[model samples]
Target: MLTLIGGGRDRTGGRGQTAAAAIHALLREEILSLRRKPGEPIAEKDIAAAHGVSRTPVREALLRLADEGLVDIIAKSGTHVSRIPLADLPEAITIRRVLEQLAVRGAVASATGSQIIELRAILVRTAEAAEAGDTEAFHRADEAFHEAVATAGRHPGVWALVRHVKLQVDRFRRLTLPLEGRMARVVAEHEAVLAAIEARDAEAAAAAMGAHVDGLSLGLDDLKRFNPGYFLEDSARSDLKRA
Candidate 1:
């Protein structure tokens, strides 16, 4: 079961609004991080009680989540964390590849010396988190590294668009985070992109970025083999065929 617990506010400051936002952020993180499994039931009553809020706030939060496709709110039935839409993976990957590769190319052309150093710092932190087996820390650093690159490239807006579709991909990535040496490989891949960018080689940087981002092919087989229950039925079969 998922629980929401945090700073409570007084009624005067639109307590319900604050509570709803708080619940929404907590639930969103849980869904994205796979702590709240896909298709898992999310009881408004339970969450309300856990957070000492009324069902009204919980409902508001859930509706907001539904807008983001993070949850599905059925009319009569209860709400559930949205399942990974495996069929959408290919399209999502394509979008991410194009936009992120462009972002890297832009970074190579426009990034400052200070920005390059900041990216290296993020990579170092990522490596340290991976070495320590801190999955959450590694994930945060990974996201930061990409965001830094996008910012360095002067394409922060593009990064926003990338994030819109990356949520689905992220759930899948979280599932594969436990594979042996996966984090280390991720670190290596980041290093490759950083190296190309640091050397001011736009072509190499784009190629490296493309390879790193599109390398989802290698993990598809493992995901189906190891965690078959996580994917949609038809999509799972399709993924297996591709694998």
Candidate 2:
């Protein structure tokens, strides 16, 4: 059974969706944050009880997660969170590196002095969030920092593509965030990228951004070492076990 964070289901939906959307968002966040571990069973009855909803909405919510590759739904079998697909890591990292490098280069070329200052201000807040050990806050700041760059670069649409590609990467990051000094290392990396941007050196910015994106791949080995069960070898996952 899953425990609802932030006071259960009543607190979640507001904009017209009272049941289905609320449950969907809650479950999606749990999956992305690794609160709901890979391959874990999602008990619809329990979720419905916790959220004070019927089984219908819970089922709908799980279906949405399934479409997002976060869960598997079988006709007669039970639903389970999808395990990390190791084979896809390289492709995801490559996509991020390519797009972010392009975005950072444009940012360096197009960002005004004030925009550069705004980016640094985001880093300062990121530091504070890291120090406070607020993972959600830190994650938000990190996203804001990158989105700021994309916006400054006048290619905000690029971020939508990055976001779609990075869903798996986000799960991996949640697993690694608790590692010793990981947040600090991220701050330093952001600073390096920002320094190049501040200098208005497109080549340096692209290089720095590439390095930062590439560093994410380095965490994969660590993730496999620490949470072997959460991921599946390419051949092992052809048919995932039902939870």
Candidate 3:
């Protein structure tokens, strides 16, 4: 079932946005965060009732989500949360890795003391989240750490571009967070990148960033085995069944 975060209340009321936009944002978050699992049905009428709005806004929100590759709308069957595109993961990870390498290199050149401090603070928060087994908090802090680095490097647009291409990767990552030692490993990787940034070594920072991003592909077969339905099956990955 599509469960709203706050008892289906209209949390966006009076936020100076249209109901469609608000609902779109809410649904997008749920989809990305894995609260709404892939292939899960999304009923328009239920969403409208949850938000106290008509079906028009719900439909509008769903259309936007479909455009973002987060929703699948069928003419006769129904709408569903789109499954993660396994084939797209490799290219998306490559793009994000390249952009983040650029970001960290730029940060090494332009990052100020305070910006570095802010990055460290975010790292600390990530570590704390990992220690507490708070996957969601760790995810947010992980994003913040990368965004801060990009901003410090004066390449905020790089982060924006990365976000656009990494949607599927993000959803895949959420699935990986609960794996044993995964969160702690991420914190360690972040430390390595931050250490290079603090040392003003552009090359090292870029290398660390690449490695960190590349690690997202690790354990893919295991994930597919555990949650087969969450990923879109690909001919190239037929071995997943054997694994």
Candidate 4:
């Protein structure tokens, strides 16, 4: 059911890159965005046919995905989208929290009027998405809000690092967004962070950003209970509990 409709090489495929890289980018987005569900089967033959590529390129793409823990390539059983690594969430969230706090502090100090306006626009979009109860739209806006903060703070590299480290956290978050009142709460938190930024209060902005990032784990136990199949069963749960 994962269809790559157009020719394999498009915007996702950069110039001079191999077909495999393009396929990898496409599949990576699908996996990260939750369009490709956890543990769902990935048939190399189907993908090859869909993209008009050979099995070799498809295999290469999948192998790269496996390296990133986005998919599992079993010897004989076929590949599947990897389940969320529960153990990795706490560390990722902590890293994200630190990075985002720094970003917000920097933004408060250096954000231009235009940058502030852009952030405000993102906040408005987030609020509208929340009001409409559009989980997917809300999630996109939420990510954009944080990314915009980092950009306004002139720390786009920090945002890049956060993105690299927060893959599992993103998946976990997607699951949480549909929960009762979660979207509205996120909007409220973003408003608080943005308000601090608007006021040029670096400390307040940092604190607000920290609190917002920390909220990612607020209902971990409930999430685990309801979506057992989506998470890995390991010592990470105990680690998170102890933290």
> Against the correct fold, how does model 4 do in TM-score?
0.91
Per-structure clash totals for the candidates: 0, 0, 0, 0
When sorted by TM-score, best at the front, the candidate numbers are 3, 4, 2, 1
- Model 3 lDDT per residue over 84-104, tens place: 989889999999999999999
- Report the Cα lDDT for residue 225, model 3: 98
RMSD of each: 5.4, 3.2, 5.1, 4.7
lDDT, residue 204, model 3: 93
- Write candidate 4's Cα lDDT for 111-132 as tens digits: 9999999989998999999999
TM per prediction? 0.87, 0.88, 0.91, 0.91
**In candidate 3, which residue pairs clash?**
none
Which candidate number maximizes lDDT?
A: 3
The CA lDDT at 220 in model 3 is 95
- For candidate 3, the lDDT comes to 0.88
Instruction: For model 3, state the Cα shift of residue 110 in Å.
Output: 0.5
Candidate 1, residue 135: CA error in Å?
0.9
lDDT of 2 by residue, 114-216 (tens): 8989999999999998898888889999999999999999889999999989988889887777777888888999999999998888888888888888877
